[model samples]
Target: MAALILILLLALILGGAGFAVHILWWIAVIVAVLWLLGFVFRSAGTGGTRGRWYRW
Candidate 1:
């Protein structure tokens, strides 16, 4: 009985995941495309402060 319940629970979770996979894949693709575009169009302003000590 316990094993049967566990199997049913696992099946439900897996079925839910499978049902949303189509939408999830599209969301992932859109995010990846946006990230690539941002990298391509990023600016190069403001140089980072290097490790330097100035004595007053």
Candidate 2:
């Protein structure tokens, strides 16, 4: 009975950690995508600065 309780506690802890990792992975992906998009726009804007004010 004590062994079963210990197993259940370990499983619960692992499950919670897995869920936390999943949430962090999604957040990392979103941040990476936003950073990539910002980098692309920065490169494009600097390539040609003339008459680009109205483009925005």
Instruction: State the C-alpha lDDT per candidate.
Output: 0.77, 0.78
* Candidate 2 lDDT: 0.78
Model 1, 1-56: lDDT tens digits are 99999999999999999979988999999999987876666555457633223223
TM-score for all models, in order of appearance: 0.49, 0.70
The residue-by-residue lDDT of candidate 2 on 1-56, one tens digit each, is 99999999999999999999999999999988987766566533554663232234
Clashing pairs in 2: none
Candidate 1 regions with alpha-carbon error over 4 angstroms: 1-16, 47-56
Model 2, which residues run further than 4 Å from truth?
Answer: 43-56
Worst 10 residues of 2 by lDDT: 47-56
Candidate 1's displacement at residue 56, Å, is: 32
